[model samples]
Target: MPTNGSQAGSKKEFQYRTQFPPDFDDEGESSGYVGFEHIVGTLIWASSQASLNLFEASNTVEAVTLERHFTVNSAPDNWQPPVDIWAQISFSWPVENSTLSLYGDEALCDLYHSETTHCRHQPLTANIVTELEIVYMFSERLVSHLDSDEGIEKTAR
Candidate 1:
C-alpha cells in the first residue's frame, strides 16, 4: 500500500499494491505455482477489478490482463511436467513494453534455487519477481499517465 512520488510532475501520488498467486504458501499440489488454474484465478480477479473501473479510482491495479496472444503446446519429447499446463501470464502494464512471465516447472525451481554449483544464482524467486514486476509496471504506468496527462484521459474513457 505504499505510494510513490510523481514522476509525471503532478501532486497526486501514485499508489500500488503487491499481489501473489493465491495459496502461494500452501504445500503439495496446492502451491501457487503448481498449475495455471490458480494463476488464472488471480488474473480473473484482476480483470474483474478492471471491469469495475477500480483501478481508475486508485491506480492500484494488481494483475493486468490475461493476454491470449501466444500459445504453447506440450511435446511428448523433451517435455517437463506442468509445462504442458503452462500459460503465459504477463505482468506488464498496458503502457509498458517490458514483460515478466511466470511459469510453474523445473526451470522456475532452478531459477529460485539458492546459489550453488548446479543452480543459477537467481536470488529473486518467481514469487518475489512477480511482486516486484507488478510494482515496477504500476510505477511505469503512473509515470506515463502523469507525464502526458493520460491518467485523466484514460479515466474518462
Candidate 2:
C-alpha cells in the first residue's frame, strides 16, 4: 500500500478504499457495486474499480427516483435487438426551454463478443447501465435547472 502524500522518509502510507458519498445514492440494493471480488481475467471485470468510479461520479438526486422498467428474454441467441434486459430510466426535468427524457438510444449490443452470455454478466451490465443513465440525467439537469424559470414539475406519480 502507498500513500498519496509522503509523511516520512520511511514512506508512511495508507490504502484508500473507494467510497460513494451519502449526498447521492441511498437505500438501493446493489446501489452501484456488483460485489465482484472473484471475477478475474476479463478486461471489464479487471477494470471493475474504474467502472464503479464512473458510476459514482454520476450521482444526482435523479438516481433515487429512477425506476427500472425493462423486459429481458434469453430463450434464443444472446446477440440481437431487445437485449435480455431492455431497460428504461424514467425521469423528467426542467431545462432551458423544455423538459428532458433520458432514454432514447441506449439500446444494448452484443453479449457474445463480451462473453456476457452468462446470466450474471448480462444482467449486471443491464442493471448498471440503467442506473448510470439515471445518474447522467441528473448531471444533464444541472444545465437546464439553471435556465428554467417557469414550467410544470410533472412526473409519473
The most accurate candidate by TM-score is 1
Q: lDDT score, residue 71, model 1?
A: 20
Q: Estimated TM-score per prediction?
A: 0.21, 0.14
- TM-score: model 2 vs. ground truth: 0.14
Report the lDDT tens digits of candidate 1 across residue range 67-134: 22212222223334433222232332221111222322223443344323343423333332222122
- Model 1 worst lDDT window (10 residues): 1-10
User: What's model 1's overall lDDT?
Assistant: 0.31
Residue 129 error, candidate 1, Å: 2.8
Model 2 lDDT, full chain set: 0.25
Q: How would you encode candidate 2's per-residue C-alpha lDDT over 40-128 as one tens digit per residue?
A: 11212323433321111111333454422221112123335423322222322222101111211112322123322323332222232
Candidate 1 off by > 4 Å: 1-40, 46-105, 108-117, 120-157
Give all candidate RMSDs, comma-separated.
20.8, 22.5
lDDT of each: 0.31, 0.25
Clashes of each: 0, 2
